[model samples]
Target chain A: MDVDRLHRRRRRWKERLMTVLIYLSVLVALLPLFSILIYVAIKGIGALNWDFFVRLPGPVGDPHAGMANAIVGTLELLLVAAAVGLPIGILAGIYLAEFGGHGLFSNSVRFLADVLSGVPSIVIGIFAYALMVLPVKHFSGWSGGVALGIMMIPVVTRTTEELIRMVPRSLREAGLALGVPRWRVTVSIVLRTAAGGLTTGAMLALARVAGETAPLLFTAFGNRYWHRSLNEPVAALTLQIYQYAISAFEDWQRQAWGAAFVLIIMVLILNILARLGTRSKFSTQQE
Target chain B: MSSSATGIPGQGHHPPAGRTGSGGTGEQPGGPLAAGGLQFSSRPRRGLADALFKAVTGAFASLILVLVLLLVLELVRSSWPSLKAFGWRFLVTQTWDPVRQQFGALPFIFGTVVSSLLALILSVPVSLGIAIYLAEMAPHWLRGPVSFLVELLAAIPSVIYGLWGIFVLVPLVRQLEVFLGTYLGFIPLFSGPPYGIGMLAAGIILAIMITPTIAAVSRDVILAVPNSQREASLALGATRWETIRNVVLEYAQSGIIGAIILGLGRALGETMAVTMVIGNRPEISASLFSFATSLTSVIANEFNESGGALHISALVELGLVLFLVTIVLNSLARFLVWQVQQRNGGAARV
Candidate 1:
């Protein structure tokens, strides 16, 4: 009886100990995030002024400089990425969700989507360079956009497919019951029904690629001033942050902090917006 | 974020082939699959719109397949020069002298593999812990917010982690390295000049960056184990820990391994964060405190400024290697996870 009691007590103690350890692990997992957030914010507070947003990035230690061109470039690049990525991603998703045959072919598409998402962004840079830049023999914003676009395809495809699949099969039946053409039903009823969720998912993918730097390193190939055309090299917020972080100047490093902080805010805002959108009635509805 | 939301009913809830494909073959008119009477409804005439829609969407789907195939072809073509020049020597050779135009990837490969494995070792336990806490222990109200925050860590840009690593993590790592070197100097892994930005820092950052992928995936897998098993264990007089250790962990083991391999793929492919703090040396070392450079980092640092054709070719070859490695890892991970979920009676929820 005493042994049984002792054994039970020991087991309870072991359970208590492991529980504490697990709690600590949570603390460890979250520590870096909070640290990065707080540290970058604290370091970047000084650079959040209007001039920091308005002026061009100056020579190494210059105080009156900003990432104006980079900010614009990032937006421009995103626009290009959206143009290249959205149509193909959404259309491909429609194929998978609406028309894909349940066989080896559709399975491979979905499988490849996972594989592509796991592909390093750097390889995409190489791909862009080889496909677009090598023939042109120069770096350009278009290549960077292409790289980010390829990266976006899988995420956008999966999300769109998922959201569209959630649209009630009964809804589809009703549309067909009205003798609506299948394409019309898909475009008007099904796509429209899931539009909010699709938009959020796209936003999440955009948020992810917006901070990409490696692919742009060789493809977009950072520019100092405003780019004249899609053919020219473009600056990206992420590339600028990378360049500045590694530079010898402390002032440039400070700007790196500011840039990192801005990038984080952009990503976090997209994430928050996506979550809110995910909570929209259509998505939160019972499957 | 969709995957991160995880338990949100419709988010990632659909299997790719679960309810899809009315067989899509336009030849089947008003047959078995046409019962829904959607596109294949009996009609007086065959319609162009339906054919066109199917054609266009099919074309787009086929394009995805073609795109990946083309990407591989492009990589092979671009890396051909280096492949021809280096032959099989490229994999095992150590020297990467750019001036004389000799390049070998042994060091970068070693660094990438070692640092990633180090991250896996350090992170899997912490990740599993977080997964267990959230899936089995945490109050229902807390799961949503905590899971979101952890996944947000994954979403934060790699460059942001690089920046933080440079200024924050490197310094802290230096202190730890020096302490370890001071007392545990006898061990090869701990003995070296305590350069702040090196293998250990890279591993630590990778571990932190990778924790979310594992934690979230494992949490989902564990949550899917069905509560009845837990009830049975509890009814059998097992302690909560015993139930979790013997049953929950057992049931979710393969899925957890898949999650870890997925994290491994991400670690192997990660570029920017490692680039910022890995000290950018090209030498293999037993000491984790030594400077190192990963395959992706070497490509990032040198691709734009590569000296000549061979140099660029070499870097592209390195990228090709990285790509193939990640593809293999991710494919393996997906297969394992799929196997378990298939047995579990459905596709996994993300």
Candidate 2:
């Protein structure tokens, strides 16, 4: 009895210690998250002004600098990326959902999408550089957008497949019973049912690509002034932040933080909204 | 919604290629229509439209495969010059001087492996702990916001992490490096001038960047472990921790490993943060404080300003290497996680 009591006491102590360690790990894991947010907010919030959002970046040591062109350029690049990525991804997803049935081809495509998602963004940058920029002999927004588009494809494809697959089989059956064509059933019934999920997925992919810096490094090849066309080098939020952060100028460093602040806010907002969107979706499904 | 339920289309099963290939012609003309076979004799026009739709969608799906093939082809084609110039010497040589055209990938490979492995080591236990906490230990109220916060961490851009790594993480790391160097002077890994922007910084920043991925995947994996496993252990009079260690974790083992491997794949490909804080010098060093470079960083930093054809080729070769390695790692990780999910009869969320 005495020995058992002692053993139990020791085990209790060990368990308590382990529990403490486990809780501490959460803190440790979240430390960087809180640190980045706190540091950026503290450093960046004070630097924000109307010019920071609207006006063009000023020369070195100029406090009147802004990142309007980068902000606009990022939006433009995203549009091009969406135009390129969404259709192919969503259509491929429909293939997997409507026609694919654990067949070898769809399985291979699924595996390829997963692997493609894992390919480093830098490699895609190189791919873009070789495929588009090298042939044109100039870095342009189009190259950057294509790189981002390629990156988005796997994410969007996977999510779109999953969402379309989520639509009840009975719905398709119901559509077919109405003498509708298979394509009409898929588009009108299946696709419509999953549209919300598709939106959320697309938003998530966009949010992810929005923060990507590596792919744009050589592709967009950031310009200092306003960019005019998809054919020309474009300023981007990430590239600008990178340029300023690495510069010797202290003011530029500050502006980098300001730009990062805007970037972070955009990314976080999209992420949160998407998560909420999925949550509501799950709740409805559960109901 | 569970994927397995809806993953199948029309419940035809994995119909063989032959059956599916001639499915349209086999149903043609409704030869001697039986009770249930083809009462309406499906219209040929509708069949054509369906075939066209399938063709279009299948063609688009094949484009993904085509895109990957194109990626491999482009990489190999562009890097052929470097391959011819370097032969096999590129992998073993350490010098990366482009001016003299001496390109060796040894240093970058070393940095990438060392830093990514270091990140895995630093992050796994913490990520597993968070996974266990969120999946099994946290009160319901705490789970929602904590998970959202973790996802928010994942949302922060890597460039911003690089920015943070530069201004915030480096200065703080300098103090740690200085302290470690002063105290652990005998250990080669810790013995060097503390630059605060070397392998150690890269590893730490990578650790921070990959934590969310590992944690989120792990949480999903642990949750996927059936409740019956835990209940059985509890019924056997095991302590909660004991049940977790012996049963829950054991069941979730492959999944957690998959999560870590996935994180590893992410770390290897990470460029912006690693590039900014890794000091960007190609060197193989035992000391964590010494400058180093990684594969992605070298590519990201030098691709644009490449000196000439050979230089660009070398970078593309490095990219090819990265692309292939990540694909292999991802496939392996997904296979492992898929195995666990198969066993537990639950879908693993990525």
Candidate 3:
């Protein structure tokens, strides 16, 4: 009886010890994320000013430099990428949801999309350089846009397909009963129902691509001056931050922090918006 | 009139045929009923429209396959010149002199493998702990917010991690190296000078970057473990910790391995953060504090400024190597995930 009691006591102590270790591990895992966010805010908040959004970057040693051109250039590149990738992604998704019949062709397409999404972004940059920059004899915003577009395709396609598949088959039957063509039923009814989710997916993809610096390092090539044409080299916020962080200039380093702050805020906002969209959709379905 | 009468009964009894015929005459092309199906005189136009839409969407779907093939072909073609010149020496040679135009992949590959494996070793325990906490221990109200925060770490860009690493992580690593070197100085792995920006710093940053991926996936896998297993263990007088350690973890072993493999893929392909903190020197060393360069980092650093054809081709070859490593890792991860799903009766969502 004495030995059994001692064994039970030791077992309880070990269990308590393991439980404490688990909680401590949680704290350790979360510490770096909170520290990084807090540090960036502390260092970056001081550099934000009206001029930071209005004026162009000054020379290397200038203390009042801003990244206005890079901000505009980033938006332009995103717009071009959206225009090129969105249509193809949505249409392909439509094919998968409506016309796909569990055949070898659709299966291969799905597999390829999965594979493409996993490819490293830097490799995609090299691909864009080989395909577009070599042919044109220069790095251009268009090449950067193409690289970003390729990255966006798989995310957009997967999300769109999932959302379209979520639309109830009963709705399609109702449209078909009313004598609507199959394609018409898909476009007018199914797509209309899935628009909100599709938009959320697109926003998430855009947010991801906006912060990509590796692809832009080679494709856009980071011009110092204001760029107006798609065929010309352009600066991007992420690329600018990379350049500033690596340079020896103290002022540039400070600006890099400021750019990092802005980029993080934009990405977080998009993520929050997507979360809200998904929540509302779920609640409505439950109701 | 005749077509309308047939359509009304056909819609009720044979919905599939009725729907097909009503959409267009393409379904009954050259059939005996073609003359009657042609009552809708715009059938030809509708048929053309349907065919056009299918063709367009199918073309777009096939484009993804073409793109993957093109990526592989282009990388091979671009790296051909170097492959022809170096034959097999490129993989074994260690010199990376751009002035002398000698390039080798051994050092970079060594750095990438060592750093990524070190990161996996450091991160797996903490990640598994977080996963278990979220899946089994956390209360209902705490699970949602904590999981969201963990996933938010993943949404943060790699470049932001790079920026944070440069200013915040490098200094702390320098201090840690001093303490380690004092105590473990006799050991070869701790014998080198501490540059602060070296394999150790890169590995730490990679551990942080990949922790969320492993935790999230592992949490899902643990949750997929049937509740009856836990209840049975408890009923048998097993402690909560014992039940989890023996039953839940054993059941989710394959899934946990899959999550680790997925994290490994991310660490190996990581470019920006690793490049920023890794000190970007081409060398194979035993010391964790020695500066090292990875495959992705080398390509990112040199591809643009390379002047000669051979130099550019060599960089492309490095890319090919990274690409092949990641593809193999990802495929293995997918297969393991599929195995987990199969074991779970196809209910595992991730």
Best by DockQ: 1
> What are the lDDT figures for the candidates, one per model?
0.84, 0.83, 0.81
Kindly provide the TM-score of model 3 when superposed on the true structure, using C-alpha atoms.
0.92
Q: How many backbone clashes does candidate 1 have?
A: 0
Order of the predicted models by lDDT, top scorer first: 1, 2, 3
Worst window of 10 by summed lDDT in candidate 1 chain A: A278-287
**Regions of model 2 farther than 4 Å from truth:** B1-42, B347-350
Please provide, for model 2 over A122-171, each residue's C-alpha lDDT reduced to its tens digit, 9 standing for 90 to 100: 99999999899999899999999999999888877877777776776566
lDDT, candidate 1, B88-130, per-residue tens: 9999999999899898999999999999999999999999999
Tell me how many clashing residue pairs each candidate has.
0, 0, 0
CAPRI grade of model 3 = acceptable
Q: Report the lDDT tens digits of candidate 3 across residue range A70-145.
A: 8888888898889877887888877866665457887688767777777888999999999999987998999999
For candidate 3, the per-residue lDDT at B25 reads 22
Q: What is each candidate's DockQ, to 2 decimals?
A: 0.62, 0.54, 0.49
Error of 1 at B42 (Å): 6.6
* lDDT of candidate model 3 versus the reference: 0.81
DockQ, model 1, C-alpha based: 0.62
Candidate 2: the clashing residue pairs are none
Considering summed lDDT, which 10 consecutive residues are worst modelled in model 2 chain A? A169-178
**By summed lDDT, which 10 consecutive residues of candidate 3 chain A come out lowest?**
A173-182
Candidate 1, residue B253: the lDDT equals: 85
